[model samples]
Target: MKDWPGPVSTCWNHWIAVPTGDQAGVMEVLSLSSPTPITFAEAQEVIDADAHGNPDDRHHLSRVFVTPEVDSWTLVIGAWCNPCDSERHEDVLRLCKALSARYGGAQAYYYGEQGDGSAWLVAEHGSVVRRYAATGELDDELLTLGDPLPQEQARRLELGLPADGDPQAASSEQIEEWTWAAFHLAPEIAAAYGVSPFTLTREAKVRGTGVLALTPDAASHGI
Candidate 1:
């Protein structure tokens, strides 16, 4: 109801997108529990508290926030989006498969707030079709999987690089040039798929509050 979270409630550090308005089904795939009716402001508080840390609790980071149906997609937000700090790409791929298996399609996106690192993943029927990420550190890329999306290929061609060329093998000059294009593609590609997480309020709203839920790992550990 009350004007769904949005463009300004934005600063989305990480999130997962699935093409369905069914939070219940999305929750099932994510293995979430205890759907507390939370406003966008309240959801932000949970994310903040997790980031702030708790003195007496060791598993404070396991909590995740879910968004109301923005356009036709439900966004599951938390550390899960970054796959536990992106230490393993397999975790990201697995999450994509899990969500896509039931949702028809799924996308995982992480737009690094503290750095230029950004990543986007696409999967259908439990298989990854495209993945791209640049850590913005000493290397040009931290991970790359499957093939480039149509938009990615076109962008690369526009930049004078081969549409299917390996960004990992780019020169320092090509790296600087193309990396700029890659990091910005996260939101652009999201817009193409369905909802750009940042501009949520711009889309039509159906009347439900977002929620704070226990992630699968947290629930398994009884945290």
Candidate 2:
């Protein structure tokens, strides 16, 4: 059997982290003049330096690996999780919008579903492209902007299989199968997004597109 690569958190999803301080937090993903992107060590320092005792409120950070066209840095935050709360889901959707507005892209991948109902979000150039259920089904109508950009379409076709075809028609089994295949190809997808596959697989790459593509072990430490 080909063993899957890494921790469940980083291994299976893409993510980003930002401060919870509203505008201040918003600036982290975007700045007026395009400030220098934060390094992985800098992001990690922030995470390690966080004094918050609560796991959910803790600051977890990861370097986004992406092409230069997509400005701004991305990190995966460790916010509190409230299962079955539509309000919580809305809160995240709002954040996704904010990231899209300020920067050009952002995304979040919950470590696991647990009480939460879904796990992935794709936002770009100030709008949400799609949202997916925990089982990888793109069923939620919570935020559907209709017709993603050409770049978004290309990336979706490349990275998100099965679910991307017709999220509404995807079954749980199909979603699971896609997840398995996607995770196994995480390194290849990461490379397509710009980072080298070998570098990402070895955890040597620090930057990547926010949840667009990622190293399998990217979220392991912060989570």
CA lDDT, every prediction?
A: 0.72, 0.38
Give the Cα error of residue 5 in candidate 2, in Å: 19
RMSD of each: 3.2, 11.1
* Best candidate according to lDDT: 1
- TM-score: model 1 vs. ground truth: 0.83
lDDT (Cα, tens digit) per residue for candidate 2, span 6-104: 121322233343223232344343322222344333433333343223435323222222221121232443332211124345656666677766666
The list of candidate 2 runs beyond 4 A from truth reads 1-14, 17-72, 80-87, 113-118, 136-164, 167-223
Mark the regions of model 1 whose C-alpha exceeds 4 Å error after superposition.
1-3, 8-12, 48-60, 137-142, 167-171, 220-222
lDDT of 1 by residue, 1-223 (tens): 4645664223436678888889898888767888888877777766656655652463544667888777677887776566325443577678779889888999887776555567888999989888777656543344667888988888888877778967566667875777787767777787888776566664466446688888766765568
